[model samples]
Target: MTSDRDWTGRVGDIWATEWRRTDRSFERLAPVLNAAIVAAAGPQAGTIVDIGCGAGATSLASAQALPDGQVIGIDLSPKLIAVANHRAGSLGNVAFRCADVASAVGMHAPVDLYVSRHGVMFFADPVAAFAQLDEAAAPGAALVFSCFAERAANRWAVETVAGADDASGPTGAMTAPGPLPLPIRPMSRRC
Candidate 1:
């Protein structure tokens, strides 16, 4: 599993340095996820939170789409947050912070929407983490996120990680906490 320690240190630094490549890796999915987020947020979303936002791409995109809304990107890595901040440049609507979203979400209470791009899987206790998010959300708030399918279904991920020497080796499948092998059931609930 990719622990918070790994993200806060080496993994985060590597991701920050390779953010361009990382973002490019998600080129196909970003548009779809962003569209879903925008659709779910609706026109009057006052505040949006991007959970585990790496370089703030989604946050920036959402901010651009909803000029009147506030977008905040939260991540566990200082390096990633720094990269996000740098990329934000003069975008006044979006901001990035380095912190654990599970614990810090309350500070941004009444969030109108929450979004993540392959980001929510890293939490040690996903239920608790999402509960925290639920606690912070405004009534009728929506959440949208994307995660890997299954290992057997993702040939690229399987092939890429086939040569791993151990479970902790370097590969998208190997490093991520809940990789392809874990089947994630779709969940929907209305509070």
Candidate 2:
């Protein structure tokens, strides 16, 4: 399946060739993800930068939350960015770019707040990538991101998806993006 990661700009499809399951979940869970991001933005009264804007789900949410401000969602997927821009026609406050996170940081002006969800964790080099983002902030600006604690701290994954290589790329996959909370299916063991 394709993905927002490989974006090409088609509505109703973000990550088309990646994990089909993720695409399925993405459509259904977009609003919830938007809500979470919107809540974190907290009033959204300033420039909001979403590193992996991902088909504008978060970017659109940011635009709504920060009506007075602008939201720039940057990603490497042209398809995804195109879809975001097409959907964002004439909005004037939200801009989605088909650019790498680092490239966007270099070109984008310093902003009030910089926000990223699961994007940062996939960096080929986290320290270097973060340093670039760190440079793109104004004084007193806030940088918030959630990263994994440690493998030892969370093993439910290790036990459940053996050999899944959860975070591995060229370096490794043990890194945590965030401990995503799955909706549980209640069991009827006894009352």
Best by lDDT: 1
lDDT of 1 at 186: 77
Q: Write the per-residue lDDT of candidate 2 for residues 79-137, one digit (tens) a residue.
A: 66666787678888898877768757767767666666556555655567767876776
Candidate 2 wrongly placed segments (more than 4 Å)? 1-44, 146-156, 163-191
Candidate 1: residue 88 Cα off by (Å) = 0.7
lDDT by residue (1-191, candidate 1, tens digit) is 68899999999999999999988998999899889988887879788999999888899999998898999999999999999999999999998989999898899988999989988878877778889999998999888888877665677876776766664435343334655535566786543
- lDDT (Cα atoms) of all candidates against the true structure: 0.85, 0.60
